[model samples]
Target: MSTARILIKHGDVRYRLLKVEAASDGSLICLLDKDPQPLKGGIRVETGKLIAEADLEKPVPYGRFSIHTTGEIHRYSGGQRKDTIHIEPLHQLTKAHAVGYFSIPTPERLDTYDASKHTADVVETLEIPTEVSERLTFLLEIGPKALKVATYGIGLSYELYTLVSRSAAARLPEELAASFVEAAALTVFDSRQIQKDEAELRFYQKIYGQGSFVFRENGGAYVALTSVPMARAPTMRVEFDGSELSIETIPFDAQNKPTHKVRFWIRDKGGRNKQHDLREHIRSVVFDARL
Candidate 1:
């Protein structure tokens, strides 16, 4: 029930809605709406060896820009041959669905534009910067059940390259032309996917902060001190059995730094007290007279 519009423009050259048809694959087909006649041959671009004679200087008019509908090819008159343009069916149009370009050749001051004039409720027309211009082409993609929008760019590069290369390949069967064209187009899509994956991974890394810690806890209390500034470590605590005057020895080096040999003293003198270092280890420093 939803519909999308495709606009094509190149400088002063502009083409509006031409034709629309229901595709066999459940998607909609569109082209220059003027032409309703059957084409003599397949529609193609004017920038190839077949049209341009491989001559760089010749004007390769836009004849190949065609529309395929109703099992016929409808080509566009490059305006050089014909004043108006027509689109036919059965052109097997690819990457011909969505495209537009904007350019402004005059100074911003000369082009009277007001942001207040912009409104989604209506189709707003604004002049583009004269300094820039571009040509864009797109395709209508239908999934297993629905239609989707796709664009044409680098993929077209490989398509053009393959079309030109295979056309020039010596003694190549014409029947295989379709296969070469597909392969060339696919290679471009694959390369784009790889580049896209890399970009996505980079974005994910930024969102998910790094650095993780994994360790096990013992029954008794344990504490870990990290030398790294501002880093927090884990601490474990184990309670004494029954306020027993039990003592654990903790040894230390001459510099007073506790080593693994260091023992800790735990005495129930009202509350538990732990002193680390063998020198400070709980010993009978003052023998009890009763003992």
Candidate 2:
């Protein structure tokens, strides 16, 4: 059986999750080793060390989305997909329901590769309101390949770190904070030329309306990144108004050009959208962002 170890560097402690896909029950065994163990067994968390003999089985979810064909209802399945997300240290603290990677519900789930060329893509318009909606869309074209989230603390399962960076960010001036994230996103796009992970794009669809990405700038649109706590798989749908579902989804490299460049940024929730920057919303009384 093929074994895989998912290692996370959070704060000062290192946490590892081992998975053996071919296992009989689709469960992961915790090992004392920092890597996946060659033998099959289970383990748990000991006071200040690794606990053995516990079997971890997270549901191997099969994420899929429907396609509107002439008559036949189409469905697409996938290799691996997650339908949730977490902000900062909260995930490390409450690791039970934490989200790591996911798929954006798409008809292309069965496709073996990512979309290299596409002029028209579905852009689900999540109405900007203190009001909630049945459906929302998150365009993956606008974001960092991966967030460089800094962490701290000490623990085996949970590398407990202070949420200082996020909290410390609560003090920055709104406008400056917004500009910084925007510039960094643009730089990552221009330099890396990366596209959103196809699986993540599908997973976002599942978590769409759960959160919203708002801007302090007038006339700016929301990207609906995160909002609902303990994100779960989305199993509902909403009827669209005419043609708002399908819009041109452009890559990040075209963000500054005249072409259609999708844009997104991290910001506070609905009422707190005024706290435009991380430092402006996150506090540093506990722990702070290093660099």
Candidate 3:
């Protein structure tokens, strides 16, 4: 039941796992690791992109870890308290089989609303990643639960983008090239007071779809938009509140090949009174595709 014991089980030979929880808004203030290193800094023992029945036989490196993930979207089994999982060995012990058992408490509440028509809660699930041990305890306070959580939702894509840049590519994996590309495509606006207005969220999402690259409103008081690829460029100038902040982007070509240099720049006045500063923001511009 303790996070430490559960994490050790997370890496068991026959597949260990635990049920971790996350907040709806996605801010994880709880620390999972006693030593608390970023998950991105840890190894990415590539849990294959998708799980197929064929993956069990796949020979992942012995020393390297595999981050196998599984999910369930069930109706809480009509008052069933637990779910059973099976674990089997690979390599020399291919034919041998064993089962590791674990269970999670059903959600305290359940509802039947909207689109899916599935119960709102009461269902729970687990995802297991292979590792030396579950050293990251804080994760339980911040990660997705197995069944109800979705792996492909928009929010997760952004979080993973942060993970890849700050931890995975920049640190252990040294996936510099790929990280650059991801960083270029992923943009995180460091806004102090973000607006949560649905109309505003939809407005910005539309601008992003238009490919205008960058959009700001309310006198730069809000983050209206950013481009997927343009966000990741290496060198660019951002003019905000009469101050210029230079941010770097990863260099990637149209063909996905590495390039010598790439840049993006932003210049928008909050209002007519600030229009005079726009020229100053555009001191110079250069884009060499050949590089």
Model 1: residue 105 alpha-carbon error in angstroms: 17
Off-target runs (Cα >4 Å) in candidate 3 are 1-237, 242-244, 257-291
lDDT of 3 by residue, 1-291 (tens): 011111222332222222222222122111111121122311222232311112223222111011111111111111221222222111011221111111111111111122243221222223345432212111110122221222311112112111110111122233321211111111112221222222223333432444323332323221212222232323444444445433234344666532212322343333223223233333333433322
Q: Ten consecutive residues with minimal summed lDDT in candidate 1? A: 158-167
Give candidate 1's TM-score.
0.20
CA displacement after TM-score superposition, residue 13 of candidate 2 (Å):
12
lDDT of all the models against the reference? 0.25, 0.22, 0.23
How high is each candidate's TM-score? Answer: 0.20, 0.15, 0.19
Stretches > 4 Å off in candidate 1: 1-5, 8-18, 23-28, 33-48, 52-132, 145-291
lDDT of 2 at 92: 16
Tell me the alpha-carbon RMSD of every candidate: 27.8, 25.2, 20.0
Q: Output the lDDT of residue 122, model 3.
A: 25
Q: Model 2 residue 33 lDDT?
A: 14
Q: What is the lDDT of residue 71 in candidate 3?
A: 12
